[model samples]
Target: MIHWRVSLSWILVWSCSLLVGIAILCFGYFDNMLSHFQQLEPSKIEHVTQAAAKQETLPRLHSSKTGLALESQAQKEKVPNKATLTYKDFPSPVQGKILRGIGNCYLAAIESYMFHPGEDFLEPEGTVIRATHRGKVIFAGHDPLLGEKVVLDCSQGWIVTYGCLENIWVKTGENVEKQEMLGQVGFNPGAEGINDQPQLHYEVRHGNTIQNIETGGSNL
Candidate 1:
């Protein structure tokens, strides 16, 4: 009986060890298979690269009044990260129908899904664009996609960006009062839509996150 009990204990121990060994082997095999399948080359990210390369280029926009191309450079705005600023409402930036709102939506013009972080308005060429809030101009220049762009830093923690325009009136470091004319909708050769209609793209941001222009209050 003693010998039988010892044999039974040994058999139980051996069985548990065998089961544990099998489990470890199975886990290792599955892990190796997953890693082998997940090891992808950079070409696997072809979708993003293809989309970027397929982006359409803009033709040189000739100023209607001067018939000459506008020349401007891009600027890097200095934001006060340490300052605690209050949020406020912005007046209408332009008079036009809203073509696009702030969110992810499909744009037929670009033939792709765009996560639009701002609002787009439709207006005729040369429509006046106004300052949403009284703020200092931090960036006023040309962008590859935004065209003639202007950025304003409202002391109350809000930063506004107006794009897809021409005939910019504000310059960097200039203080502009609310409702002041900053620019006008023009050729917008870098416009988002291929419809050939003049559109204004406006963005309001607090910190690094963009706020909805149509909404009354800030979500930041």
Candidate 2:
């Protein structure tokens, strides 16, 4: 009976030991799986972040490239060449009789009547003014006397001015071509000052001096 009791106690102790070992193995396996999942979670998060960043940056890059291409094209179109162009070939915005010519440049001392400087084409109000040449816009804004005005500096000693405009379509330093719409003619309250008439005032200046539109063989 004593030997049987000792054998039974040893058997119970071995069983308990085997159960503890199995539990430890199972816990270790599950812990390893959890650690692997945590590592994969960070990798997935990084991938998603990188993808989002690319999506955000690509559209802006495309837009910038497109804008640069457009500006380059406009610049290319503004290059001017010297050619004999007539006013009949050129379209006029205002359709009226020639008003007054730039009579003379009055120097304080000298009273010599030089040839008229610029020709004045007087058209009724609301005429769509067009650009005379292909060039970059030098000025497009308002003045106290001119009202809304646009000036184009066609390279090679040609500059055109449109006055009494209702609105300006292009801004300063913009590229424009011949016959392009500069603006529309409007009534300037200060054109005649006292005798305000609804008319379009146009001028062409070469270098510092104004060119006579009539005698210059440039007609409206």
Candidate 3:
């Protein structure tokens, strides 16, 4: 009986060792896979390169007077609530390099879960951001993710937005002219995985759809 008990004890110890070995193997496999996924190649980022190419030939925008005239006509004609925005209805809000272009971004071989809704202009901190069209300030305040944000209502469902601002120059309900200073660009705290780079986020909305400001207009 003593010999039998010794044999049983040895079997139990071997079982525990085998289980621990298996756990270590599983952990190592997962760790390696995670690391591989985290180190995405820069060449895999197609959108960034494509946008960089497009920026070199971005079209010149019409003067501020054209934007004002378009706004006036839209208001006079009583355009529908879901007015379709033309390229001439807006202008570039900033003059800077496109940091992160509109759409998805790739990092560490991982694709972003959400599509970027606007263009990011890499400008210096405190660089002025202007309104792209004649409109009324609808929102001008701090946002949890965007920091300082400003939204302009251009009437007839057309709207323009500026984000990542350091200072806002206009107030809600105030009318702003095209090319008018709205605010200054600010540094992002990497809340959305972006580093502390100074940039202005610009978006043009016609009702619900967000327009591509690069192809849609200059500077964006």
lDDT of each: 0.77, 0.71, 0.77
Q: What tens-digit string does per-residue lDDT give for candidate 1 at 1-220?
A: 9999999999999999999999999999999988975786667657656766656322222234234322221122333355554434665577689887877777665567867767888988889999877899999999876788899999766888898889999899999998999998877654365366789988888877777656655442
- Candidate with more favorable, higher TM-score: 2 or 3: 3
lDDT of 2 by residue, 1-220 (tens): 9999999999999999999999999999999998886778777979988999999999999999999999999998998755754443334455687655566433222334444344456666777788867778888888776678888877766777877788789999999988889888678775332146666667786666655555655322
Error of 2 at 62 (Å): 41
Clash numbers, per candidate: 0, 0, 2
Candidate 2: RMSD over Cα atoms? 13.5
Query: Measured by TM-score, how close is model 3 to the native structure?
Result: 0.55
Worst 10 residues of 1 by lDDT: 68-77
Pairs with steric clashes in candidate 1: none
TM-scores for all candidates? 0.55, 0.50, 0.55
Which of candidates 2 and 3 reaches a greater lDDT? Answer: 3
**C-alpha RMSD of candidate 1:** 27.5
Model 3: which ten-residue window has the lowest total lDDT? 105-114
Residue 20 lDDT in candidate 3: 100
RMSD of each: 27.5, 13.5, 33.0
